[model samples]
Target: MSQQTTETTPARLPAAARRGGGPPWMGAGMPAEKSMNFLPSAKRLMGRLRPHRLQLIGVITLVVASVSLSVIGPKILGHATDIIFSGVIGKQLPPGTTTEQAVEGARAAGNDSFADIIAKANVLPGVGIDFDRLGRVLLLVMLLFAGASLLSWLAGYILNGVVQRTVRQLRSDVEDKLNRLPLPYFDKQPRGELLSRVTNDIDNISTSLQQTLSQLLTSLLTVVGVVVMMFVISPLLALVALVAVPLSVWVTKQIAKRSQKQFVAQWKHTGALNGQIEEAFTGHELVKVFGRQREIEASFAAKNDELFKASFGAQFVSGIIMPSMMFIGNLSYVAIAVIGGLRVASGAMSLGDVQAFIQYSRQFTQPLTQVASMANLLQSGVASAERVFDLLDAEEQSPDPVKPAPLTDRHGRVEFERVSFRYEHDKPLIEDLSLVAEPGHTVAIVGPTGAGKTTLVNLVMRFYELDSGRITLDGVDLTELRRDTLRSEIGMVLQDTWLFGGTIRENIAYGNPEASEEQILAAAKATFVDRFVRSLPDGYDTVIDEEGSNVSAGERQLITIARAFLSNPSLLILDEATSSVDTRTEVLLQRAMAALRSDRTSFVIAHRLSTIRDAHLILVMESGRIVEQGTHAELLAAEGAYHRLYHAQFSQPAIDVDEATPPPAVPGAPLLRQR
Candidate 1:
């Protein structure tokens, strides 16, 4: 309500260094190697999964069942082949004996044994094999395969539900963390990078959970089971297959080591690319005004190309792992086949045993290759997890007091007692500054840009804690009172007006949502906002777009003023609150502010000298120090900093106030001495 210039004055405002002085989109990209503690990160990742321990155990059990069932099929089929051979050679399982006992007895019969005679029995013409035994064996094998598949499906179903719920919890935690983080954290981080953490990084973990996790488990189980089967069938053949294991492991490790680096770069470039796109789109107007479309496109293309190269390197390197392991596996198979055949010819092994052994060898090598291929996806997932956990592990702000003192009586008596504050430890901005504003007084603060005017206000609001001294409101230390309690009694109107997407009535009622429609209308009328609202097609119901683009800048300022009026706080801080309105509109606003500030204490920060001529007291600041303070007449007589600033602002046709005709003053306004 105070008379203050609403015109834009960039020179009087300091650049926000924490925002990094550019589009929020121009933040640095992710580092290539943030940390190399893989084992620790992996452990933490598993720790997160611990919540679903039951589901994981289910998956493992199903995997074991599935692998065992699959492994049994080949052995069953091999036994059937042996039976058909016996039928052809006119030999049968010894009368009333099961196939197992007959085979063991024939093996003990040695060279030209009954096993060989029985195998030749199936060769006789018109000597049909027994169909009964073959039918039962085939049926059992089919049933085992179906049961294994059914278990796998159930395991996958359970895992899907578990993964989704786990991700939901993770996303919720990140959202909560954002609200608790201190202002400094946001200042140093990019909007897009934070977004990537929530969206991209978390999504990668989801994919790994849905696919890589299960695949890795199945592959490991297959490898272990096959190795055991190979040794049981024939130790010599198993030894030959075992040779491929070490070679596959060594090759996989070498490729993964290189691919891991590429995967890290890929994700890093992805974050940087996202940041550039966000910046370009958000500031499209500025880009066009400066004719920077080509430049932005160029920058985008460069980042995209970098991402492409990294992605290609990671994927291609991982892709080779499967084929390389297959080659070694095939070589092992050939060696095992030749050795087993020679042993069979010498009557040391049966054809069925040799066939089963070869099958197990193939199974053993397949899973090793699968595991190697999935290593890329797992590595990338771990990288993403590391970034997410880092955000969760960040240091939080100091906790609120368990029992805070209540701010009572609500007298707007504010005092700063030797306060000092600095954004950085080495560069002290405000050193031992002190001032006082009595109840029901209009105190004006005028200073050049970066002179710490805003910093002082920030300290009073406790946006940043002071390094020393204490601020008192109504004779009580501000720190002892709850922030919400202190802030509730004080109303603020910042220069950059923020009006969300909502109706005019809603925007005005934002400060006091519980206010009735009549109260909202009254507040709007006080600030002349009602006049404009009535002119709109929907009146007060007219919805404002994002950034309030539908209304002119002046109209937006009026609505903000209306919001402040609706709050009806005990104290007010106006940081060039009327800087956007025209001179005519400003005059109306000044009357509204006068009525609003009549009873409540106010601190008005302004750059224009004429606006604060009737203030009860004025403080002139320079380089974070209060250099002069007094009423207009007293400061002009002193002929100091305020004198120079006053004369500079009104050098032409200066109107001098006669002692006989005193400037107007609100009745009962306190007069505080300048120190």
Candidate 2:
């Protein structure tokens, strides 16, 4: 007979949706806006590079060498220009006349200013240009430029290696941290949002480091080298160039400050959006069944629009930085050009020196512009780093004992001693509950939803710890035994079957990897899984899809039961294990479980009264307390809570009393129940 199963409530809505006031996207639980700590986050990110200190030092050395060469090249070219200019003027002078004679002649012609320029130029009055010297200077300048390029490339190569290694280590740390976190932590965090932090945010950090690190380092060094060269050529021109520094700094600072918030919002929405998408896809069938496609689409559109706004705001604000810096730099450039021309004409500076200083000025402004332009990438990367760091800093689960107690025997005797637990502080679910199940007995638990039926078995598995009391196995406190040790002797088959994407044979073997082929086949036959496997084209080799959707629900449940049978555990837990199978199949499963339960303890949670009629002990639970405990006939005669539950299941119209009747008890089929 098929029993009617009531659908449980959908997952709890976000707090905002429950209150009935907020944007549609807020249903995703969008994170509240928090002020970004830019400097601290940036500093923390740099600290990730600490392990590569030696490599960084090498990179710095190379950059310094490269910048130095670059700085000196223009000055050498300027000297070559001076040589050419002086030779041209000397060639125009009268034959056999010295440089002093040319100056004297200009002065006598009442051209004192021109005479001063002639003196500063140091013209050889009777000589033409020195072609040999000019050629040598030119060749030397080309070599300096080439050497600078080579060193710069080498520095970038080493820096790239350092960034990749650092990011790799960071990924490994996040993965490890995830495993160390407590189960409750996962309950509170959406899987999609967590995935974004692990994937998208980390990728952003890697890209930021790759694109900005080398360029920022080179730009700053170039700025310093250019300034020094500028002062060497003419201190006045260098000071004029420096007037733009404060303005550029102010511009970058202001823009970065505004854009930082938008970047934070952008990534935050990205995670929220990913979470929505994940949930929608995971429950796609449920959505379609309820005709909620439009609602889901609306929610998605709202979140997408919010993300677009955040991304646009971040880019638009940071985009203003380059043009503003360029304007300030251009103003400085015009001032230097005017002052340099006047100085040259007045004989206060040589034409070659002025030419070189102009080059230095351009070099100075260009790097500043480059640095300013990189603000967008830097801010976005730092924002992502902050998210990744938050995950790494989450509180971890309590550690296992340094010295754990040993479990020498495989006896399945279990006991709960005055246990107390609650998911929340103010709401207690189970209080001072105690029970005992002897070895070789089947204990059946029956209860309505939220009656603490599943919670009781979960406690025995140590999926959670009790608030006030401890559980014991074979007279030993469960806490003293290592979790892995305790779990190794136990096997569980839940109502919701979980199977990985693999062949049927592989899935069955997952429970006991070392089990021989004969053992696997025996387990399959015992659970009646072999009956279905033989009908498939590939038999045991049939591949299950990732979602296990290719098989029927009853078939999936049978596979899980077969897996548990293969484990040969000392204790077994079957929660609604036979609910998905038909009445005939359930009869066969009951027979298989009877054989499997011989000389081993078992806990069965069931709503169908027919399944547990033969159990050794039946526990009737109500509001976290056991209201009745006894055999089916004994409880029916007593007319207690169990009598009411038994009568309720048989009285239902959908369950025909004759068809719902359980078969005669098989020898050694001991079990317990609570409802």
Candidate 3:
């Protein structure tokens, strides 16, 4: 590790202009629009169902059995009521003479009204009600129903356990999928929408599945079993109850269609809100600095308003479904009642049959509503799954070819052979180009703002692939080597640096996790940042991260340089290494860099231009093509493009007479050898 020296110098780091930051909770670069099929994502969600199948089946069995038990008791109670009343009334009444004799006696007494009342009193002689027999029967039935309820509750506890655990696994799986997805897939999605899928969508499914699966089975079993019992009692009454199911279904379908789009819109608006909030958090200081606080607030207000409308629309419309189903269900129940009652009155059905048919009619409509409610939740889950799976299934980082041979030894040789590439295929940012740098040689590339300098470096790093031709390290084609193995042998100091949450010691040691504390301190001292670290109250123990309210650009950059110094790769890429520092810091950074780059193949892209005057070889690029190459003295003698650009800088040290700067030569003009 090398130390970079830092002097107390004032300077400004360049501002970043491209990133949108993040949207609220989703972070930055979430997708703005949705794509991908809901069906595929849903099919994927079904795979989660497979592991919970046994519990699912158990829940189904218990709920159905509980519902079946519900119908059994009422019928058994009715039979017991009838039998016990007959036995008690028979015990109380004369062996042969029934309540009919009392009615005849009353008629003989010439009281017509009393005669009718006496005839109506059958259970006990001259009394209208059967109290003793009925009370005993009612008591037994109540006890039986209470016991069945106890069993139902016990089974319900088991189903609750299943619901919670199943949902937990599903949530974990969705998150695992997101983690496995490549960086580019997240680049295309909105964070808020993604969150909704993982949270709201999965929640919807869990809630619906738990309630609907358990109750739907119960309602369905009750409806079917009760109808069968009704048929056993009187088939004519059972037929009347089936006629109303179709009408209830039609109502539910119409309501579900209206609410579907609302939920989708709700998800989208929430994403936009999330995006706005993320931007605010990342740039809160900027908002104040630029005096754009009002603008940001207004934008947020609009997003909130839109979110409010969308959320209300979805919830309000979906809420209507249950009540509407119930309304239709009520009307159907009434119609069944009238028809069943008429059948019973006409001798086509018994009283028990009529009672059961009414109960079953209610049962039939209840499941219909349960299913409709389930559909709403299922639709939401499916929509969310669509968004999440789009990311999960999208193209990811391709693994290295099987059994790739490692680079024999980089020895710091890099070459681009007739390379042509574009980020967007047709843009052709880098046209057919070729270049090479040998071990221990310094390659300085200088270019105008969009002259494809960074693109060249990106290709070398394999962050993006070439559309044509190849890049090679140590004469081995880049694609032929394992990406990890190749990259591990290289070190980089990027213009932008990030520090994770940890102590300064840990941050430096991050360059190589196995590095001892002594090595970390040595590396920091080499980057010239050790003096400041020692001044801090905690020294190496000082914790730093993005959230750290302290730590400036110069401090961060020095630490990064120290990290690279510790890495000590044979091939080094320093991109605008000292671009962020003041003159004093730059000079110290340059000293540290010189120590680090010693005897290594270094590619330095310097915006300062002054820093690279000592490069062993300088390559000048324009419009993606290398147009100039030579030592400082040779390029100055030629008086070419390098010469012109070198002279254009506002500040320059008095150059060696042979050093590159305009006049006798023009950059890109021609190569010349001078003795």
Q: Using TM-score as the measure, which candidate wins?
A: 2
Residue 417 deviation, candidate 1, in Å? 1.8
Model 2 lDDT at residue 387: 91
lDDT of 3 by residue, 372-441 (tens): 6666666665656555555456665666678787677758899889999754544556888988888888
Ranking of predictions according to lDDT = 2, 1, 3
The superposed Cα distance between candidate 1 and the true structure at residue 147, in angstroms, equals: 2.3
Off by over 4 Å in 2: 1-26, 29-36, 87-96, 107-117, 125-131, 514-543, 654-675
Clash totals in order = 11, 15, 27
Give the whole-model CA lDDT for all candidates, comma-separated.
Answer: 0.78, 0.85, 0.69
**Candidate 1 residue lDDT tens string, 475-544:** 8888888777787888888787878889999889988989999999999999999988888999999999
Candidate 3's error at 178, in angstroms? 5.7
| Decoy 3 TM-score against native | 0.77
